[model samples]
Target: MAIYSSAVFPPSQLWDYAVKLYNNPEVSAACLRLQDRRGLDVNMLLFSVWVAASGRGRLTDAEMIAGIEAGARWQADVVAPLRHVRRYLKGDIAPADNRLAAELGRGISDSELFAEHMELQFLNEILTRPATGSFGAAERGEAAADNLAAYLGHVTRDISRDDLSDLLQIWQQAFPGADPRLTGLFGPSLQ
Candidate 1:
């Protein structure tokens, strides 16, 4: 993972924002649910939110696709396998002793997290500069929604409205102060 300091990518503040958002339990749970159930990429989702929060306009479909593609190999070959190992160890499927399994699981989890950080670094490197203007919460939400939708379309042939709603609900919960227009976009179905 690339560590950013005052000397590196002076304008890149999205990584810090992403770290804070990912640290939130609600956001982490939502991201895991999206990944486990919908085959969505958690890194991309975080990237979308980071982009929007940083005042960048919604990423174009091409940009979203590019970001996903950039990290796909590392995600598939490294992170996914680490996650699978960790999850398998947590379940009855693992033949190892409980103590050993738990220890391995913790190590795998740490490795997976490190892999995620690397993906974030790759994403941060490719993102275009934020737009030179202020964006309200509503605009940020719209951009996040658009970017997420594009990612969904790229990953799955048939996009589910329910899944999208679930994502928005979590986003709303995580950011209750977001503009009402954003809440409206997700519709009244989200509670």
Candidate 2:
């Protein structure tokens, strides 16, 4: 594993948004499920919400593609590999008395986080220019839903019912104060 220097990259709004959201247990589990089962990019998922929260109403298909492409190579080459190793270490491969494997797993986990931070930074560069349509707080929740659906639509047309549930969990966590009317909007609104 390699060490990553945080001094090289300052945190951005997207990073801050992601950290707070992912810290929620439900959100983190849902995100991991989407990543592991649905082949979704968690950073891209978080980016969509961040953009919406930032008041950018909805992302165009082209914009969604750009976000996906921005960190594709890095995610494939760096982040995924590090995650694979870190997960691989969570087994009985090591002798009972050995702490080396556990310590190595911790290092790999940190490196994975650093790689994700780098990927978020890359995605943030594309958002430097202001988007045309901006929404206020009331609309931001709907905007967040639209942005997530846009990003998910880019991945697959057939979003399963369970996927919507996970997405709803994520959306609710992202916008805890979203109107009750806006709550449970994923099924029909997202489609």
Candidate 3:
């Protein structure tokens, strides 16, 4: 989790643009094709961005290790799942209100879990960066696509605490009962 400035990322018209790229049949086909041939997790650039934005997005250090262990893990398999996760975390859509409720078998969707995670991860301070970075359309598109790929990287595993100090305070306040160990994991700034 990173305490990104709202000035760094706010919700915006980019949402539609992102979805448009996401829903493109040809893009989907190309993605799927890439997945089958190169095994999806191909791009290091996507992984780098995802690793930066989402804090290993996985749930645990072990999971992070596993991802690294999965030699040749491309960024493809991770994109869609990351997109799916972002949709819930960013509040663009309610997780419980969607199809996820039917999949997790909890009478609740993973989205609900994610919504809380977003709070614990980034929203606890009542802070949310506007999606307003100076990244150009191409950069934004690249970020979105890579993030989508990262979704897959995280879903099958747990989140890590790589750059988590940026969000630890929020997590401490939002989930006072959170594991002391968990908070410790993201305690100090990397620098």
Candidate 4:
């Protein structure tokens, strides 16, 4: 894990914000859909949201790719396996006592949560100062959309416009009636 000598762009508050936003049932479902169907990184998705919310502008394509690479190993080896096990235990695919499965599920959930924290820490290592100068909500939204599109492009060469739109809509709805500064970044109406 990388250690920070000073406060990073996404301080603890923004991390907390990511956690809260991700925990929303709708947001969680959308994240899973993007992850399972589109091969998107949930952490990166949440990171983009954090960046937009914190007035950090948006990640460049290179930054998004680097961030994805930085966290790929831990995410694939630790988080994904834990998640697979937890989900497997939930289904009839695995035969185990209800009590034992439940206990193991809780442990797996904790491990996954810890792994996510580690991912966030890794991402913090590469954090840059928010973009200089003021930007309107629409501009920020466009930046975020572009960042997400770049990420999707990396995952699959043929990125679907509709999929991108759906993903953006999910993120926009995640935090409705947000702060005035952030409202425009989510969608046009909020702007």
TM-score of each: 0.79, 0.87, 0.24, 0.76
TM-score-best of 3 and 4:
4
Candidate 3 residue 189 Cα shift, in angstroms, is: 39
lDDT of 4 by residue, 1-191 (tens): 22222233346655687788877777788788788877677888877766655667777666777888977877888889988998877766445688787777777777677677778877766776854558666555656655665666677776555465556555566445333234322244334
- Model 2 clashing residue pairs (backbone): none
- Model 4 has a clash total of 0
Top TM-score model: 2
| Residue runs of model 3 more than 4 Å from their true location after superposition | 1-19, 41-130, 138-191
Q: Write the per-residue lDDT of candidate 1 for residues 1-191, one digit (tens) a residue.
A: 22233334334466677778878787788788778887778888888777776688678777787898987887889888988888889987535688887877787877787677778878887865756568877777767766666677788876566676567755665456775344444544444
Per-model RMSD to reference: 4.3, 3.0, 18.0, 6.1
Pick the lDDT winner.
Answer: 2
Off by over 4 Å in 1: 1-12, 92-95, 131-133, 173-175, 179-191
TM-score, cand. 1: 0.79
lDDT of 2 by residue, 84-105 (tens): 9998888877565337888888
Local distance difference test scores for all models: 0.72, 0.81, 0.35, 0.68
Residues 38-144 of candidate 3 have per-residue lDDT tens digits of 44332221232333233223223343334434423322243344445554444534546545533332322343333323322221122223334455433433333
